[model samples]
Target: MTTISDGVTVVDHPLVRHKLTLMREKDRSTKSFRQLLNEIGMLLCYEVTRDLPMEMTEIETPLTKSMQPIIAGKKMVFAPILRAGVGFLDGMLELVPAARVAHIGLYRDPNTLQAVEYYFKAPSDIAERMVVVMDPMLATANSAVAAIDRLKERGAKDLRFVCLLAAPEGIERFRGAHPDVRIWTAAIDEKLNEHGYIVPGLGDAGDRMFGTR
Candidate 1:
């Protein structure tokens, strides 16, 4: 992992770079895009959970008993911002099937480029669990910040944000809003365009993933 800043990590694994490149192709089919995303999500998940706390427990083998390490403490919560964020959920869940899910629904206002939330659901004990917020793109960061705001209001304290791509402006905005939270992403792109879309980014992640465009 490449550290872009104090709390930002870029998952620069070869497989992650290769799959992200494939997904960036404009001609790539929705099926291929979704598949690549899922694969990359799994890779990113592995990197993100690398430093999770572990505890030793005794397990019985055929020949003898052995002490094995397992994730300790409360199961983490995977909080995904709606639609595009959902694309990362399946692959992440495949790795951490025991993790809980919290869904935050928000959309960007086209003209103002602000996040507007319509739904939010989470476990009652969210504050006690680590919350990893997943969103495929972090361009303006309005959605990410808004989602985290709602999460904090609901008592979630330990939080992390994950994305497929991010813009410098978005990173600054996100870090400025929530300095305590760490960020994990496949790559940090150039910048956001006039309409708040990441330059050189695989355009409209939600549209691309769902074939809605």
Candidate 2:
């Protein structure tokens, strides 16, 4: 892992980079792209949860009794921002099946490039749990910032943001809006394009994942 700043980490694992490169190929099929994303999601999940608190638990073995470390405290919530973010859920769930899910639906306006929320659902006790927000690309950060704003209004305190790729502009915007929340990403690209997409990023993650235009 590489620390870009006090709260930003880049997961530079070889497998993650390899899979991400495959997903970036122009001719990659929908099925292959989705599969690679899921795999990378699992890998990223491992990196992001590395510092979770642990407690010793007593267990009986055939030969003797022993204590083992297990995750402690209330289960975390995985908050995915709409269509593209959902692509990261299944792989993360494979590693953290007990985690609760929160869905935040927001779409970017073509003209203004602002986030508009359409749906929000989360646990009533969200205030008591850690929340990890997932989005594949942090291009303009409009959607990410809006999603976190809603979650904070709902009483979420401890929160983190994860993405497959990030643009420098998006990072700056997101940090400026929500500096308290840490970020984990596989790679931080150069910058955002004229249309607010990350340059060198796999285009339109939602459309690519869902096979939509």
Candidate 3:
């Protein structure tokens, strides 16, 4: 497990690693890519919510009474940074069907390489629940940073960031920018390319996911 710093976790499970390898391949079909993304998303979700508060509640079995542990609190909010982020939704939803979803749309300007927001919609009570921001890539950290900023503006307090891959520079920038938010990712690659793309990354996640390119 590679540790970048506090508030960052790299999932070291074999299953996560194996699936990530397939996703990183250039020849992966769109259908297969989407399926692998969902499967991996579910795996990452498990680790992300590992420490959620749980309380024991009284329960009755067919032959006896017992206490079972249940998650304590309002349903979690899944905030996917639209486009590429939507690819992770199905898998996360499968694990947390009751989770509320919020959409944040951001695009990077080629010249400035900065995140520009086009849309933002979230639950009014999002601040009352834990929010997990999902995106498949964290390359320049522009989009991730902006998305979290918007979430905070909308009253979201407890938040976590999850992604499939990240560049070392991106992770460093993000961690420095948002030290309070925990980051979870499958792998942290070498660095960002000249155009702000993660080296050894699976190319444009949005394009691969939707077959746009």
Candidate 4:
């Protein structure tokens, strides 16, 4: 229950914790893993959109017409960081069906451990909307930082970062790089291993989720 000064929100819901435990287990099947990720993604989506602007508007109910509060103002854009980020898409879309999607492809260089961008595509009106960048693992923060940089270069003004697992080092570096960006994560683990993987993390999310490794 540590509150970070860096606008990092650690969602402490019991459902998130329970599913994370299942995901962390090495024996979990690929099918179960993906299913759990979607469930957890839905929960995280709920928490992250809490501050969405709402305006009162007239609406019709089953038996009566009345003014109801509805989401208003800037639209939402979900920028998922390639393959791994895809796992969270269905759940997030279930919450905000009208939100646009942006895809950013980045891969870590094994030798230098740097993030290299492969592809980037986003909505034309990115600057006018709220962008939420999704990546399941925030281990090195290099990809997250680079991805946000690309988005800003393309005129994305409002941005938030969401991930399933994050490390203290990665979170610190990410916050320092973009203090304006809010971070929402399910769990912040101990630290990264020598291989740059979060300790006690769910492992390479893309590999496990896609059975690539």
Q: Which TM-score value belongs to model 2?
A: 0.98
Quote each prediction's TM-score: 0.99, 0.98, 0.97, 0.97
Q: Write the per-residue lDDT of candidate 2 for residues 4-111, one digit (tens) a residue.
A: 898899999999999999999988999998888899999999988999999999999899999999999998999999999998999999999999999999999999
Q: After superposition, how far is residue 22 of candidate 4 from its true place, in Å?
A: 0.3
> What are the lDDT figures for the candidates, one per model?
0.94, 0.94, 0.92, 0.93
Q: RMSD in angstroms, all models?
A: 0.6, 0.7, 1.0, 1.2
Model 3 score (lDDT):
0.92
Residue range 1-213, candidate 1, lDDT tens digits: 899799899999999999999999999999999999888889999988989999999999999999999999998899999989989999999999999999999999998999999999999999999999999999999999999999999999999999999999999999999999999999999999999999899999999999999
lDDT of 3 by residue, 1-213 (tens): 455668889997899999999999999999999999999999999999989999999999998999999999898999999899998899999999999999999999999999999999998899899999999999999999999999998888999999999898888888888889999999989989899999888999999988999
For model 4, residues 142-186, the per-residue Cα lDDT tens digits are: 999999999999999999999999999999899899999999999
On lDDT, who's better, 2 or 3?
Answer: 2
Point out the higher-scoring one by TM-score: 2 or 3.
2
How much lDDT does candidate 2 score?
A: 0.94
